[model samples]
Target: MTAALPRADVAPVAPAKRRRHALGWLAVVPLLVFTAIAFGLPALAVLDGAFTAKDPATGATSYTTGNLTTSLQGPYLTALLGSVKLSAVSAALGALLGLPLAQAVVGSRSRALREAVLTASGVLANFGGVPLAFAFVATLGNAGVLTVRLGLKDSGWDLYSFWGLVLVYLYFLIPLMVLTITPALEGLRSQWREAALNNGATGAQYWRHVALHVLAPSLLGGLVLLFGSAFAAYATAAAMVGSAVPLVTLQIADALSGNVLVGQENVALALSLDMVLVAGLVMAVYLPLQRRSARWLDA
Candidate 1:
């Protein structure tokens, strides 16, 4: 009876699974660290500074809402509104142009054509900031080659004006819209189209009822993304128009760099907070639309 003691059996743990999980976490660590360093800390600093004011004489920091109040008044408000209008207009124009371009590429029978369009889009979407500003200036400025050749200056076309900025913004915005909406366009199911046709729906009716309905979410999301991109853009406008344009980004730079009124750095932080809020709101709207788009597109 004593020799009949039972031995308990235990399953062996999978070392490979544990190792793979560890590697996955390890791979993510760098990205996590980078995000915290690049975005998280700066955001925190800005938030903190937005609600706190510093005394120039004593260099003492105190909690106050003056920065926020100041940001929403006068020139700051005007700059904010200008930025909003510019972003909205540019995004709308991008959507108008990009949708047709995306459709053209998607509907094309040639794979090479599709690839070429996509490649061009990828390049142009990122063709922004200083280099883009330089390109536009060299091509469209008062003494630009084309401007001189075509006598565009005589037509009162100034490349440093509000409308000019919109055109420059569209260079990047249109391509971004194309890239964003192309996937949604491709996700349109052929069977759905066939079904609509079989049900005696004309092409226009099919688009109005089925295709547009399905594509609306993606389109709206892409527009929101473009809006945010245009809203936050700085370098292009700065390089092209300098302080000629009263953009929020320009104001922020002025405040931070002491190029405008000195000791208004806190105001810059407040401006940044406003920009973040606007961007956050855009993303909030975009996320739900993107989710809805994915529900049908990924199906």
Candidate 2:
């Protein structure tokens, strides 16, 4: 009788917990496979190609620093500079525009205005490539309706110029910056503002002492993201300005699609090298921003 009672007191296995554990890992399996096949393999290919170069005379592929060095020469350098400059300007403009808009959105008493701002931001954030290009062209291009309506001479403005590219890039970039930075701004509590006010601090002083400290890291991160987005953009520039602007992405696309550099693997290698250098620049910006973000969050 005692042995039978002991047997009845034994713990039952948790089938539900086991089933949940199995399902969780099963869900992860597809994602793991997708990452390996899609992102991992291509990334490996790029890494391999970046290091190895084909011999022009023998048509044999081998590793060489020369190809990478040649890749860093004049054209790539010019394009890299242009791309960086364009992206930096776009990010700066976006931040400037975003800050005020974010402030308004966060500070607004009207629910309608906040909803409208959010909706507008969503639409504009996804507005890129050909459609954005055409939007800019329509507003600023020679034959555009706005241009015709304004009766401004074609010589008064050129939407295909480098400045024009900056403007067009900013159109989409500003909304993204707002979306990115607004969360950080809105996350900040009203207590900080009230405390600062109670301490006899001016509005500017409060912003500088409290708000800026809290938001600086996130702002920097958003700038990095924006800069990267604009730097990597190809279609907007191509559709609006063409290769006449001399961006690194344009160079790569030209190598792959058009004359002089078409089907040239070496040039592609060079283009990849150019891309690496730009990537380095982006990382340089991003690392410091991340460090700053960590510090702010810790504080």
Candidate 3:
């Protein structure tokens, strides 16, 4: 007998699947191209420049680790540390304030109240940058309405100070914390509490053993997000504090513009690389915890 031929249907099935796969990929092409142009290419350029140094006299370029080393020294190091400190402090503060607010919102009896808070949080979380700076300045600055009326400047309060920056940061940070942690808070089931109570467990015991334990991962994830947000923020800080603050973002801007020190463009790129690494590390820690938290929350 002749060798059995593959079924006609089977022969077309492979090509059909291949065509479907190609079409699926075609749908993603626009996104991939956009990412490459907006993020990938710029990131590659930063990475390339961070490792390359140019000679002023010869106008020649060479690869070196000098930029990385320079980034870790003196003012650069200080700015990096400051950025870390600011991010950590602001994140902590946001968590402290937001946890209670989120719990309040989640526990509220009225659906309207919950929706209102969430809607407000969403708006306020994105209400940063120059307009936010202007609003704060108008409300709390030296000549601001509140400051002028309260005479707070005479009380040794300056809106341009570090603590002032923290206060301004809180305006958005708290709302961000609320938006992130609200869903996690809502994930907590009433049955868990009832079960604990039926088992003769106190409220404190339930929270200590069950609630907090389950919520810990999500809380940490929210903090990580807030930290990253604070760390990468540039416009608000730029508008509110200008060069008065020694932030890494400001230093990067100064270096890139050749305003603070000329020939430090590579150093700025190195700083940018440093920021990417920091943000990457935060997300690295966040993602696994977020995944673990989601498992329980979704259940």
Candidate 4:
């Protein structure tokens, strides 16, 4: 017998799938356009300015690495280091506090409690920028009501310093972490706990030996989110402390606004590039961990 001919349905399957995939991408065309316009264009502009140097007298433009070199030298490097330090510490503390709080909320039987906590977290997480700065300044800054009444300033509490910024950052960062890890906390299957208990494991043992292993990726991902959130923070830091703290965001602002040094705008752009690279690194680590967590959680 001659070799059987392929069925009509089978022959058309690949093209039909390709068409569906094309339609899927087409559906997201608007979003892709928006992203290009909003993010991609600005990024390109920053990248160009970061490497382009302008001559003052001749009004000439040329590509150079001087801006990048300047950004990595002197106080700029200090500010970058300070920003990384602040983001790391804030993210760590936020994760520590948020994970437990999320766990408590998730483990509770009261749906109302869980709803209330999540609602509050969602609000507080977004409650940053200038308004947040003002709130903290009023509550903890020098001559603040609480500061005076509670004698916190006399106790050496300064809300315009590095540690103080860390505290302010934590206000929102903790809530953000809670929101991020809540789903991961919920993704934790009850069966795992049951199985652990059935195997004569204690609560702490179950977590240390079983639950923590599974939650590790999600936890790290949430920490990355918090780090990025804090790293890119500007308004709150700028308003609260100005240049009192050596933060890269403040350095960028000062450079752009000519508040620190005039005609260092290119350096500001280079700093922006640096921040972008750091953020890219954070995302690279986060995306893979998130994918792994999702796979395990879904399975």
- Candidate 4 segments whose C-alpha is farther than 4 A from its true place: 1-15
- In the range 48-80, model 1's lDDT, one tens digit per residue, is 999999888998989999999999999999999
Clashing pairs in 3: none
CA lDDT for candidate 3: 0.95
- Taking the tens digit of each residue's C-alpha lDDT, what string does model 3 give over 45-126? 9999999999999999999999999999999999999899999999999999999999999999999999999999999998
TM-score, candidate 1, is 0.91
Tens-place lDDT per residue, model 2, 48-106, is 77677676578798876665665567786688678888888989999988888988998
lDDT on C-alpha atoms for all candidate structures = 0.95, 0.80, 0.95, 0.95
Show the lowest summed lDDT stretch of 10 residues, model 2: 3-12
Residue 296 of model 1 has an lDDT of 88
**Which of the two, 2 or 3, has more lDDT?**
3
Clash number by candidate, in order? 0, 0, 0, 0
Question: What order do candidates take by TM-score, descending?
Answer: 4, 3, 1, 2
